[model samples]
Target: MENKKRIPNWLKIIALLIFIIGGYFGWTAYTTFLASNVTDNQKYLYINTGDTYLQVLQKIKDQKIVEDPNSFDRAAKYQNYTESVKPGRYALTPGMNNRRFIGNLRGGYQDAVKFRFENIRLKENFAGKLAENFEADSITFLKLLNDENLAKSYGFTKDNFIAMFIPNTYELYWNTAPEKLFARFHDEWKKFWTKDRLAKAKAINLTPQEVSSLAAIVKGEALHKDEMPAIAGLYLNRLQKGMLLQADPTVIFATQDFTIRRVLNKHLRTDNPYNTYIYKGLPPGPIMMPSIVAIDAVLNYKHHDYIYMCAKEDFSGYHAFATNVAEHQINARKFQKALDERNIKK
Candidate 1:
């Protein structure tokens, strides 16, 4: 057999050097693009609207989501994520590599926030709450709510716009714009008013807005869910008889002093239109964002001749119903005596 030619020493050395250098680069690339770079902890990255890429990087650094900031920055730049930053709430999971993280940021792969609003007493409070979970500021949401033209477009007045927002949990992106959010609420409101519900409103000779307003009053008065229908019926009776609602909750809303445990004569005398004792019909809008339970109670109210309601003396959160002035006075006296015993003189 012919003898194999031995490779030159210098050429062997060069080949070995090339192999070592290539292996080192390949390992570095794997660490930067494929190896787990995110910390092994659950973390959320909130990128606000108009945020710069550098700001987003700073947020990541602040949250301590990534193991190496330089490697993440390198991956972001390589994937052109620095030029295509998207505003959103993103979830950073364990074992996430820089490549996948940068891809998510560039592709707008964001997580949805579980948004819930209920028992909100005022539009300002609602706006503030929205701002807490969203990229938009409170002022932005308030401006949209107060926009008369925008409200009119959705078939609602600025005062009654709160009625459109049904109290429930929703899945919404954190960066949803104010206009889109309002549209979503309007869509939900429409979904709530089915044909059967519309027919019920017509039977009661009330609009959906009116029902919502009454439901808010019912909610404020009745502490127990079982008593909501009776309270709603009482208010309906007062409405039909052209009697003042005289709802104490309305007076509380009018006074804007939520700490008042007792509705005194002074509270009743509040000059605001929301004071049902002063106004003849339901106030301009709902006093609060009524619950679905209260709204349904108004739609299916308990029919009765009783026109007056007084909280029971035992503070059991139940009410005593009466048909005549004498019985109502008796119930009122019992409640008043209880209040006096407790020294609740607000």
Candidate 2:
């Protein structure tokens, strides 16, 4: 009389299966959106130019930054990131979820690279350094630097183009093209040559390029910043009196052999535009990438009547200045004797 209808066991089994499936889907959604899916290590991802979306995903997988690649792929797909790939250097921190990772790549937010160059002595070396930092190759950068037409478009000759790059720490993007890199350098040069700087250059009766040429010599001569102004002033004196610059640094550059520690008589006889000893004016280009300190020292050179300079006999990276040939000869003799004593015959 009280036989109640029992629920079917199959129905209960089916309901339990539905609950389990729903829980699994919910967990996947959470991991894809809100849960942390990356491993516990900070990493960096560089998406270079011409990299495809699949290649980028493969790179991420190779880095093992994400704990769940499936979720990340799904999230990236959902965000439509595959349609627009951006190239940049992205930093991947620990515990990053798929949403955060995909959002960063989609937004095209990248980090800046710190680039610095000093004592760069050749255009090839400069090109290689730039290639190491940017997306462009060394050959491409060198081509642009050596191209007469391209350099003229920027108000420079292939000879004096080195003056455009001021040696200082610059913040640049990793994927910057060769022309964009040149544009940035040109902009920096323009900013450096402010009205006040131009006035100072005018006061000295030297253009910016001429000042750079002299500054390069001063930089090559003096190792200490404290003596640059004095060296610059001495060279200015030489230029004012229409004397040969006779800068030993120019001889070393003209030889194209930086191994020459001492500029010998033969080195000075090199017949090149860069040989200030043979020529009567500044070299056609900078001997090295001059620093800002050297450039400014030239602009604010010490007012002295000394027209000749020889490195000190002590080898302490300082120099001796003389206003007359007799004093210069005496200083030169002392330095020569010191070199002889050290057996430094170039």
Number of the top-ranking candidate, with TM-score as the measure: 1
Over 1-346, each residue of candidate 2 has an lDDT whose tens digit, in order, gives: 9999998999999999999999999987897888888785545788988899999889888888788878888898989998778999887878888888889888988878899998888899999999888778899999988988887887888998988999989999989888888999999999999999999999999999888988999999999999999999999988989999999999989889889977788887899999988899888888988889999999999999999889999999999889999999999999999999999988
Q: Which run of 10 residues does model 2 get worst, by summed lDDT?
A: 37-46
Model 2 residue runs over 4 Å out of place are: 1-11, 39-42
- C-alpha lDDT score of every prediction, in listed order: 0.92, 0.89
| Candidate 1: regions farther than 4 A off | 1-8, 40-42
Question: How far out, in Å, is residue 44 in model 1?
Answer: 1.4
Q: Evaluate residue 95 in candidate 2 and report its C-alpha lDDT on the 0 to 100 scale.
A: 87
Model 1, residue 39: distance off in Å is 2.1
**lDDT string, candidate 1, 156-188, tens digits:** 898888899999999999999888988998999
Highest lDDT model number:
1
In candidate 1 the C-alpha lDDT for residue 231 amounts to 92
Candidate 1 accuracy as lDDT = 0.92
